[model samples]
Target: MGSTRIAVVVASTGRPEELGRWKEHILRQTLQPSRFVFAVVKPSDLPSSDAMLPCAEVVYCNPGLPVQRNAALELLLGATHIIAFFDDDYVPSAYCLEGIVDFFQRHSAVVAVNGSLLADGINTAGIPYEEAIALVDANDRNGKPEAKVICSLDGLYGCNMVYRSAAIGAERFDENLPLYAWQEDIDFAARVGRRGGLALTTAFAGVHQGVKAARLAGVRLGYSQIANPVYLMRKGTLSFKAGIRLIARNLVMNHVRAFKPEPWIDRRGRCKGNWIGILDLVIGRDHPKNILSIRQ
Candidate 1:
């Protein structure tokens, strides 16, 4: 805890505007990250110019969340005490980083901590950036209690999770789980959790803007919905019960909602993809990256 160097790693593509909006909040954290790494598919994924350019490092990688994440992990391993992953559109309270630092310092056995969310926009039409920031700012002003609510969890949520670098050692994300890398967090956490403890806590918190831009095609996401969990379950990173549950939930939502889909979601495309996934499941042809080959 004495020399805890925290570094932030963000993976994104086609959302340079999101990075610009997220940058100010990251810099204003009460305990700033020792290093700021933005892993992207190309130079364009970042703003053309930024006042914080000198303080941040940009690493380009193949287009995928897991690929970019692993790139940052490789770069930050020896230099960082903790590595934090925040989605590009997320808005964290000013105390977010400081709260996490305190949480880990107090709970030495915890391998990773998934922060509580003030509000998550992923379930609906994406939250506007300004609205997300306002929600975060209001929560910050209300005061954050020191009293902690912690519980053991089988996995960490990807949007805003922090991990102890030492605990991570040589581990890496599954690069094959391309693009948004659905369920990648659960797979990563489920394995690392066995080495120590995994926790869900209120000490750290943020808002998930869930900007819908740069998302993978609905059919692709739909395909991963079924294939990835089956793959992970076989890989032993996901339990059979959990895998089945994920597969059922996604399939049902896609089908039921296809009739009256949200303007923000591609429920119809997802439904078709779900059928393709089921056929692949029976024929032994599905893979998470299979989505990459499927045409929109």
Candidate 2:
């Protein structure tokens, strides 16, 4: 057994098939996790067959990214030395988790790490399994960096984030922002950084397939896009300049893309939502929690 007790927490909703695919990739890791915890919004969301995946635990909770991720924390109180989070749509290389373990073992001062995203795009629907595997392999080959460890990153990417359990005592993902909960990872990473260093490493890497379906409506996501950063800024979790930059980028992209949206995205809807958020801000109605009023 490895000296470190590694655990994986995957928060998923309405993506059983994708969860199965992700599980297949995770099981391929060379240094296996002592616990593989899958948190779903509802128990019924997972098909009976998927319950057979070689996981140490499966938990059901209220439907929301932050809430689901936070729920997994309860299950890990005394279970793991390291905890890693992965979006259900990603496919990590066999060495991803193994490399993470090695990095934490070497860099004792580092509390959190994010892996390189090998292949991520706006659309990846209807991709065949063979094609997906080829894509991951191609990305893995091309994304290999000269330096194994890159330090002092501002935050961890939600797609592939790992943390030393000791560094996150009593800290849980913030659940106030609803749905996509934009910038939740940044908020969490910033808190973790307060304790120790944050790093992005080529040593641990994965492919974010960017699944097209089963996502929040574009308007809801757009509102969160605009409101979440501002909320974080107010809470001092995010900088004002950084928050504006993020908002401006999304505002432009959503508007421009709305004119000619990609096949898989709701660009116009997001653009509309962005407008609603801006208007709310103008009228002193800016609230990240307002996302709950939106119908899925």
Candidate 3:
């Protein structure tokens, strides 16, 4: 295949050490990307020159994941053809780019592809090398050839997904939800799929070092897990019927997993924030801001 410019966008905040490890993994990739960009909440929060990855262009954000992602997209717009996004704590395989590039070339209709993510805790040194190697190899074995649009009502995961620059155009992560994480991927992917874009799952994968939520501001990491999907549903990106199904499934699973101590946590929070978000929509709260964030 020709040298397609692929941009890897890493939206990070408060994980300098994990970011350093991810940088090393990117440097060691078998099929190097045409370009790499690191989108951070604060460039000053990043490490010194010695710790930073060579050739990585860093862009600062306003302490929000969607904001950081949008900034990264804006910066990489003209320079890259494929935009691959990863979390700060995930380390990709050496062949990650190669596999994604191959899939894009082979599937002309595919607009996005997500690599499998294996959850590994923070102590990488504690994990045996063989185990890590096996996790990477597992992705290679799971590779499948298929062409279809992913339209699950719940939407896609942002951790290890790649997107087509042209298909997305000026569309970007919605900033209305405002939390630093969650549901943004699902919102974007649902829009893309509705607009005739295809999202695929590939064998090339990465290992996510499950960085503890307590490390970064105790920002209620799982709150978005409950909020974002509901916000999307109320906004009409996800149908009400489908939204109900999705919520039901999530509630059941959370119960099985015993999500939080109180069963009424989600119910209560949704009653508060979702109603306000809906009213905000009716009264035109921050609509201009939302529109501006997506402007090309």
Candidate 4:
């Protein structure tokens, strides 16, 4: 696949530094994209050309991960054969784009592919750029050899996934899913999976650089933890049992971890939010949109 055949879409909000780091990584890719589209919630926050790595078309969209991504998709219409979405905070390997194009070329039946994370943990935002690269290098040294492909994943990781344009026609990310759109990628990828196949690959890779400081307020994320899964279950994207498992795991972890909070996580705040969500659910008010109405 030629560089002209792929387009890269990045959805970002208020995290200029991380986005810059990601842009540098993308600009250094072995296989460059035909176009780079950066979507930000506030148009004013879009980086000027002088600060950008290359000529990227910056777009303004409402503040939601899925909504921003869909905005990028609109601009990319008919522009490329493949569309790849990367979180603004992730630092993908140099061969990431090359691996994506290669896999799609080799597997005509596959609609999407998720790149593996070099690190076991997600919070790499505070690490220096040089150290972050070193960490990925360290992981690669001790990590298992890269696999050509892994079969049968339910969906793509939102952080690093690529899709064939033809397979994704008319399908857009669920806008109803609010900020961060927790699990929106899973819902969208499951739709793609139903049309064809979905797989993950070690050959394609990235580091999440979670960017805890840029994350949603602890309470918002906490509420989403419980409310979002239930919402997905209600929408048929997640089974009831699966939703229960997700909620239970989060509730338990938040409760337990609050006692021994990790520096990278706001465990107590999340736990408080979890209980608030549960209380809301019990009172027949578990909808996610209700979050905006609540006073923090």
Candidate 5:
């Protein structure tokens, strides 16, 4: 098996306490990564030192998910063969990296692998793994032995996915997707797949501590879920039918039912606005905005 140098990129905006927990989980991993990099958005917000963890590198960058991811990607580029993306709220299983390395080694054609996201069962703050599983698309079920499955265009969620550094090349998360909430992963995955890469989902998992979505300028940003997919679809990421299905599913199943009535109405309105944005994207009306600008 090839010696795959793994770089775990933890992108965060705030929550030093959660970072500490994540750090603990990383340090205890059975298959240690070559390097562990925590890319924090606002450095001043994090603890001055997480000295407990060895070989830990922390980077602070402008407060955007794409920008933070790009910063981590740049730092990790030449240093590792496989780069795994993990969010700040996640605490990975001890075997997460080991499973990734083994999967990649055994499945040479796989360009990316996604892990299951379990909710912390103890807290009212987090969604339980069972609940999270209920949220997955029925068609995108995981198979044994890391076999390739037909994933929907919207299948690649960012919370726990690994990418081949070489296949990614200089391509980074779309900077124009200013809102960190939604379709960036779908867009990135589509780009990778279109370029002859495959993304796989595995039973191996990680735990999300159930943090609320980050706020932008005191208001919780919902653009990614509301707008980004529409933008992505207009950009030709998904077929017309797939795009309609995604929007319908979000509107009927995920958004309206899950959110409060008032916020749901407001978010629905925003989603409507994105239809126009989608048209604009297609007809060349407004250029896409930078992802960093949307972060508070």
Candidate 6:
């Protein structure tokens, strides 16, 4: 990547303290980013006054993953050669940025790369911030194993995805998915990578705390579990088979777990939302944005 610069973007809400706690990771990166942008819904979404991070830019936007990210994107379009998006709770290895530059330099065919994850808490209760940092630190200390491209991917994972800014040109995250914008990454990556390729890479790795805070309402997320995939399938970003599997997997899990929902999850609410979404589909309304209309 030579003189070309890499910029980082983070779209976060209600995680001011988390960002404050993790800001030092920016200083630890082996190759610093030329730009670090944060997209927030409100002023308080940033770090507290006493704990402010230096050399970072903030952009305000309505509260939705796509909209926030797109807001940040506007600032970096022609200013950078590469752009990486990290979730607020993600802790990347010290050489993460170096790995990203290396991976891109070596793989000209890949348009986007999803960093490998040492641990992801989204599937379970969620990893503690300290635990996530410990994992990242251990990786940094023991040996920053050489980063390598791992596998092909249909969509870059949202927690830690990197792309060549030139490849992105006018592409943006889809705002129609709204709020948490479930599967929005798939939609965006599919569109952006149509000219090239998408891949998973070990050139960089991170721990995703998947902190439960600031998530969308259960009804909206559950509704997205159904409607979002269908919407993507119709738009041709998601295959019919893949979309059906996603919908079925969520519906089955919600059904089976509704009787004994995890403490961290709202299985009953999600199940109700799933049913509501299905009914809407039956009535010729399968739009993903419809979740916004479902009152709490």
How many backbone overlaps does candidate 4 show? 0
Whose lDDT is greatest here?
6
* TM value for model 5: 0.75
Q: TM-score ranking from best to worst?
A: 6, 1, 2, 4, 5, 3
Evaluated at residue 295, the lDDT of candidate 6 is: 76
Backbone clash total, candidate 1: 0
Collision count for each candidate, in order: 0, 0, 1, 0, 2, 2
lDDT of 4: 0.79
**Which clashing pairs does model 6 show?**
147-203, 148-203
Model 3 TM-score, all chains together: 0.74
Off by over 4 Å in 2: 47-51, 122-129, 137-147
Q: Candidate 5's error at 31, in angstroms? A: 1.0
lDDT per residue as tens, model 1, 89-168? 88898888888888888888898988888889999898887888888888888776352646899988899989999989
lDDT of 5: 0.63
Taking the tens digit of each residue's C-alpha lDDT, what string does model 4 give over 1-296? 55548988889888776666656776667778888888998855566556686668888878888889999999986878999998876777777778778778777788888888765335423545566687666654553335468766887788888899888889999987777788899889988777788888766776776666567777777888888888888888787888899899989988888988888788888887788889998999898776665555
C-alpha-based local distance difference test score of model 2:
0.81
**Worst lDDT 10-window in candidate 1:** 142-151
TM-score of each: 0.96, 0.92, 0.74, 0.91, 0.75, 0.97
lDDT of 5 by residue, 149-219 (tens): 33533346677778888878867888777645456777777777654546544535666656664534221
- Indicate the TM-score of model 1: 0.96
Query: In order, what lDDT does every prediction score?
Result: 0.87, 0.81, 0.64, 0.79, 0.63, 0.88
- Against the true structure, whose TM-score is highest? 6
lDDT of 2 at 257: 78
For candidate 3, the per-residue lDDT at 193 reads 59
lDDT: which is higher, 1 or 5?
A: 1
Instruction: Report the candidate with higher TM-score, 3 versus 6.
Output: 6
